[model samples]
Target chain A: MDVKPARRTDSHFVASLEKAMRVLEAFGPEQARLGLTELSIETGLDRSSVQRLTTTLHQLGYLDKDATTKRFSPSIRMTELANRYLWSDDLVKSAMPRLIDLRQALGETINFSRLDGTDIVYTARLPSSRTSYAAMIIGRRVPALNTSSGRVMLALREPGERQRAIEEWPMQRFTSQTTMDREAVKRLVEEAAETGYSIAENELQMNELALAVAVNRNGEPGGAIHCSVSGTVWTRERLREDVMPRLRDVANAIG
Target chain B: MDVKPARRTDSHFVASLEKAMRVLEAFGPEQARLGLTELSIETGLDRSSVQRLTTTLHQLGYLDKDATTKRFSPSIRMTELANRYLWSDDLVKSAMPRLIDLRQALGETINFSRLDGTDIVYTARLPSSRTSYAAMIIGRRVPALNTSSGRVMLALREPGERQRAIEEWPMQRFTSQTTMDREAVKRLVEEAAETGYSIAENELQMNELALAVAVNRNGEPGGAIHCSVSGTVWTRERLREDVMPRLRDVANAIG
Candidate 1:
């Protein structure tokens, strides 16, 4: 998912947060440093507004101003904030060893993602380290239904969950092969649950094939973990015969 | 440093970002799955605010909501943001290999940082792989005068430049070793420029000895690179004699 945050709460304070986000977004792939005038121009706010925000931010550790140069730059407060967000999650870190093992054993990109309402969001990833995917960056999020990882996660959701997701938002196809019909998605969820695994071939149209399984922790469905491979590797029969058992074993081990 | 940005830009926006941050933060070392009301209680935000923020965040890739259960959880957007940050600096990435090589040869925590006005922001770090230091999270920023890295960068600043930083904000005594006199600090900067490096012992009170060299690029001192050893490891003399050459070489290579 391009890592854009969803819309914000309409609290009286939302505008301030939006402004702050604009300032943060203002510093991107380029333009790492700014003077107050530069930030105001970039953010489309008056200098007074930018100055007020920056002053508070500087005090709080988000932005640091050079005492001599009068230039402003980001501070370690960004990491501190990110850590406050989800850095404390052991689940993501806990999956590291197994993710490393899965990457080595399967030679495919591996991911661990959790369910967010109807969609799935990845929390941990071990790129096919020896031969990186060259496609996925570590933290990008994708649809829960379109990916093998998503399908595996969706399978574990309670029965009405499938209908709700489809109802809440009709499937938006990620690729030509992505399923859009509610009935088809429902069937996929059901079958995958019964089989204890999910497989998708050329569905993501990265032309990747994937096998996925879910983790059960303390009787709760944790999330899905999947192994993905490019087109050259997949044959349907191989997925069923060669990959499914090992995928199941990995799931069991995590459970 | 914490991975999350705690101090976002304007205080007005603090609520929005904090709410969004809290929604992600809601998933902690534990408590991965949280129903809307539960989320409200956990964050001390109202149910409606929590619900709205969670819904928007879900759409934006930061949060995932389970439709059937109406619970909220963290999405992979956290990792995506982290990776986005890691790759933000092309210059730092290119310098990483040489930085690592120098760290190993020097047997100290080697670091490179850019001057962001008054603060020295660390863009790259090669910690002693064989040992651990206090805190060395990449993207962390530190005070310029308080650190050898900062002092080295400050040494290259023009007379007006160094004068401005001190005048804008008088130096605060961060540690027993921090020099409080502006005139004294200025003289030290002059000495550092003449000698081509700066050294500080127990300056930040970590009881460490450090040496730093400024990387002058295009007739401007762009940044500083430093190597540090614990007082427990290198006697002041050994550090002065043994470590200075490696630091100079590393800085030269960087320039």
Candidate 2:
């Protein structure tokens, strides 16, 4: 085991709290659960200390012990902890009423979004009608460069900020259909800015069609809301004619 | 200011990490962002420690700072850390595909859920529409005894465990419709067992309608998947005929 870093003579830092935060922060998208050995190896903390902390965490219900293996994994308590986010007004919770109404009117999926850096973070999303893709969670971050929701958020940003973001990371074709150049993006956003809505066809995902209208709060927004349908069922023309109008109506309702 | 708790003892605990975790954990649902003074008060850590730790966290992109106010808040990067749980196969991530299909087919909100002692934890949720009421987040929890997802999860528990649970704490209704009787709950579980799904109508929330079905490995579930809609729009007939069939269909798809 790696030794604890020698403390400064001044005891300037609370080494234990830092270590515990490291253990907490060490848990990420790739390393959700860990045994004592894994925690020891991962954090370079002594096995004894790791074991002690995990035990404490378990006692507090942040983790659970596997019956046979005795390995420690995140308890649902971790979800409770995450629930305490600053954006705790649960986009999912507040939006459900409007979201369900929109879904019923549109007969498809919808997403409630917020800006995270330049990317569009899906704070809340209704499910798509088909079963194939990955589930979009409340905190899921996808490229602002790729999603229709991302673009709308960018469109909502100040022009200078938008330009900087596009320059910082321009679009890449996720499949064959994503917009590839800054010009294409600007034109799309310009039209959206003019017409008050945007559409992306097979832009980020194969066989995905999405339409979004910015929900201006009272005509102001914390961010945007989007309603989408599968390209598999709704062709581009039908979506533009049918889905767009309903999405706009919902966006206006939110606004 | 309260004196440092860990400092009072020179025990083996790593003070810095624990203090840092407390600093981070101090930002809960009610208090999402805080200035150094607030952080100091919340964690009972000195202002300097809070400043230094938040600086490191901000540098790492896990915390964000307001330049003018110098208040520290959690960044979405914290969600990225929690997303690790969603990728753990056969744990939570494994259910995304089914969860998506269920949401899409039902055109109602769907979630991958689990039991955390007395609470039901929503790991992943597919919203049905654009309105917000039932706030959703990765680590959010609702008392298990008070929700459809919770009841379904509780029903899956070993009989002895269930008995001990109600025995330990009888149910309390959050809304008038919330179950408050332990014997009544046992009866409800019996009904749920016979019917093979769970329903909560304006129970947890007076105006929300929710139904849940467990996603089982065989007869037992790794977790549950739930669909919630606004009670205003749903009739009992619609729920029984329309929602239950679709909810069970999705449940059947569960591994």
Candidate 3:
């Protein structure tokens, strides 16, 4: 296993807390329940430490252990924290009603996502009635370069940070239509900035087309408001003519 | 100031990690964006420890510091964890579509909540068109004795634990109709268990009536599924005739 980064020696840094967070981070969309050995490998913590930390977390009502599986998963208490965290964001709170309105008006999924790390996390989502996919779930994260929301927010980032982010993120091709070429993606970001909106056509998934516009607060881009349409029904021309204007109107209203 | 509980002497328990969680817990519906002194007081940590923990949390992107106010709030990164945490619950994942269906049918706000501590935190919610209250926000906690969901879950708890919980929780009067009598609240819980459902009329709020049925998984009440209607619109007879059967049907289907 690859060795994890050495803990920061900064006096104020609580190593134990960081380690605990690392344990929590080890669980994701795929690895929901994990055993001690798996968690040890994932978090790069020793088995005993993982056991201790998981036990402590379980005792605190943050982690639940399945008696049959002998694996641990985050308990419902974490949902409380997640709910508070989303509502605490002023930008998210203000955009919610408007996002709901747009979802009703368009009959498509509506999302409000903010850039965090090299990804965009959906802070709020109103799923389309026809959607079978759970893509619009609040808190689901997608790659920064792969999503229209990410590209829209990345396009608005300060030049130096944007360049660093572009270089840092891996441009993996998710589908046949996904542009893995760095220069092509850079052009897409630039075009999005110039046009005040961005679109990703079957980049993340073969049957999805997403378009986004950045929501600004006091001239600073806070996040992106976006809508995803099923590619089976939506073409680029139709998306631009039908969905883009309403999306932009909502973003502008939020800004 | 009241003294905080002493840290467990167990070698496996990570004291610093627990302290950090306490800091996170300190920020709630009321106490968002707390300063160093306020956090110290809230967490019952010395100023220096609070400073170090908050600084570390800020650096890790879990907490964000406002440059002008010097107060810290949860950053967007925290939302990532929150998303993963909610998705980790099997009960929540299975109930989502059914909850959506019930919300549409009843045209009233639907909520799924689980008993946590002396409160019930909303695990999932689908708001009705006419709903204006944000009380159903996922993770929003309400008194277990005051809501139908809470009563349903509490009714199923071990008698000793339920009694202890009732003693522990502060039965604050939220409305004139809220029953503050402990014996009366216990009787409501007992009635819920006998009837296989629960109701709260003008309890938490003056004009809101809530009905709930336990989402049983393997005969154990896993959580409660509930719907709230404006008392102005929903009479007890209509609630029983129209909403109760549908609520019980969804709960049974999920179970």
Error of 2 at A86 (Å): 6.7
Taking all chains together, each candidate's TM-score versus the true structure is 0.51, 0.73, 0.90
Docking class of 1: incorrect
How accurately is candidate 3 docked according to DockQ?
0.47
lDDT of 2 by residue, A1-255 (tens): 122455323345444545555565556555656777888888888988887677655554555688887876655555554565535444444555777677666656677776666666655556653523343545566677677777765676677876777778645567887788887787777676677777888876777778776766543345677766677677868977877777676666555
Instruction: Name the candidate that leads on TM-score.
Output: 3
lDDT tens per residue, model 1, A1-255: 232343333342345545665666566445656888899999988887787777666655566677987877765445433343343454554555566555555655676677654556665554432223223333444667666667666666677865676556435576677777767777777888798788877666656777788887764667777777776757767777866777677667767
Worst 10 residues of 1 chain B by lDDT: B129-138
- Which DockQ values do the candidates obtain, in the order shown? 0.15, 0.33, 0.47
True contacts kept of 3: 0.53
Clashes within 3 Å, all models in order: 28, 43, 0
**Rank list by DockQ:** 3, 2, 1
True-structure lDDT of candidate 1: 0.63
Candidate 2's error at B37, in angstroms? 5.1
Ranking by TM-score: 3, 2, 1
TM-score: model 2 vs. ground truth: 0.73
Clashing pairs in 3: none
